[model samples]
Target: MGGFEDREKAFEAKYARDEEVAFRVTARRNRLLGQWAAAQMKLTPEETEAYAKSVVQADFEEAGDEDVVRKLVGDLTAAGIAIDESTVRVAIEEMAAEARRQFMEAK
Candidate 1:
């Protein structure tokens, strides 16, 4: 019984670690994407990082990528980037499509 409990604890710990790693990887990917988008707006590196972090904050769990893209569009617009809704929508769709591709690839 003691060995069984120990094995269960070990399994839980491994799952926790995996979840953390997955979260970090997703976070880093979003930050990188934000930085890439910010570059197109001619923002400084620090500004880009700030922008990226903000994007990460809007994740809101399952909403995830769409929310990030939505916020990116809003932030860029607020920064006077001259982007319109149609363009932002298009970009969001494209990104979602790309993510779908990556997800399928991973499987």
Candidate 2:
């Protein structure tokens, strides 16, 4: 009985760790996506960093990535970047994958 209880506790701990990692990865991915957009928009280095932080903050506007996507699409369009929502969505996916890979490697 003790062994079973220990296993359950271990599983719960692992789940919590995974959730934290996932949140960190999503933030990193958003930052990277923002940097990419900033580059495309010809933002200066200082502006790029600030823009990335704004992108990270945009995630808080909702429960999921839709808010981030919407923010990116609107900002990019306003900056004359000529990007569509689908392209931003694809970039978000790609950045997420890259973020996960980088996080795993760091672990």
Find the candidate with the highest lDDT and give its number.
2
How do the predictions measure up, each by TM-score? 0.64, 0.94
Those runs of model 2 whose alpha carbons end farther than 4 Å from true positions after fitting are none
In candidate 1, what are the lDDT values of residues 2-106, reduced to their tens digit?
A: 999999999999999888766665666666667757886888988888977876677864554667767777778877887765776675566555555565576
Weakest ten-residue segment in model 2 by summed lDDT:
76-85
lDDT of 2 by residue, 1-107 (tens): 99999999999999999899989999999999989999999999999999999999999989988999899999989987888999999999999999999998998
What lDDT is obtained when candidate 2 is compared to the true structure? Answer: 0.94
Q: Looking at candidate 1, what is the lDDT of residue 106?
A: 69
Task: Estimate candidate 1's RMSD in Å.
Answer: 5.3
Question: Over all chains combined, what TM-score does candidate 1 have?
Answer: 0.64
* Candidate 1 stretches greater than 4 Å from native: 61-63, 76-107
Tell me the whole-model lDDT of each prediction, alpha carbons only: 0.71, 0.94
